[model samples]
Target: MATVRVQQADFDIGAEVAAVTAGRTDIGGTGCFIGTVRETADGRPITAMTLEHYPGMTERAMAAIAEQAEARWSLLGCTLIHRVGRLTPGANIVLVLAAAPHRQAALEATAFLIDWLKTRAPFWKKEHFADGAEAWVAARVEDDAAAARWGGGTAGRDRRTMAPGGSG
Candidate 1:
């Protein structure tokens, strides 16, 4: 099973990793990725970003992502946590962990989870600039390409076209 959380609170990565691997001797490796709010986007200085999502829908989409990774790899455990509401520069926004008996599976599963989450998850973001202006974040073509490389069936679709809880 995997731990999935969508919240407005910050997470402690060390505590999360310890919790997942606690008493698990069979787990040989754990791959982790932490995404943070950056100070700039496309050269514009960002003061903050607000992440919003449909409550029930967001968790369902994330659960499907974890399930897919589990099906594709021999995972011992997995954890995904995404923060919503306003975030400042250097604040952690998301955390992903993939545990397996080998490094390869753990690493690949971590990539797959983040890729799919970026493109498929039901979340919207709006960035606030230092100039007192705000704009909704646009989907990058490169993100879609990264997710498509796995061939999980979400290839070539515009980010806005995704339906709630729908894969790919």
Candidate 2:
């Protein structure tokens, strides 16, 4: 089963990796992706970022994405952790781990998870700029393109058009 968590607390990468690999000799490779709050976005200096999501809906979407990755690849295990609330630059925002019997499967699954999460998950972000201005983050075309590469039309949909309770 895949472990999916949506929390306000930070996650320990080492512990997460260990938990996925513990007593699992069949796992050969584990692809990991840790996303951190960057100091800048599109050349604008950022002080902090706040992420918000609907509790039940967000977890369900993440779990579904994880399941999709597992079904598409030969994954032995997977872990996805996304942080909410306020976050400063350099703070961890999300983590993804996909373990498989082969490196290719693990790597591809990791990529797919992150890409889909960026578009599919119903997470709203607000950026605090260095000048004390705050603005809601907009969805990027690049993210949609990345997710579309996985061959799903739903992945390319604009998140802004999604209904309040719908997953993009």
- Top candidate on lDDT is 2
Show the lowest summed lDDT stretch of 10 residues, model 2. 154-163
- Relative to the unseen true structure, what is the C-alpha lDDT of residue 84 in candidate 2, on a scale of 0 to 100? 99
For model 2, state the Cα shift of residue 120 in Å: 0.5
Residue-level error in angstroms, candidate 2, position 72: 0.8
Candidate 2 stretches greater than 4 Å from native? 155-168
Q: Model 2 Cα displacement at 2 (Å)?
A: 0.4
Model 1, span 1-168: residue lDDT tens: 899999999999999999889998999999999999999989999999999998998898899889889889879999999999999999999999999999999999999999999987888999999999999998787988899899967442235436788653
Give the alpha-carbon lDDT of every model. 0.91, 0.92
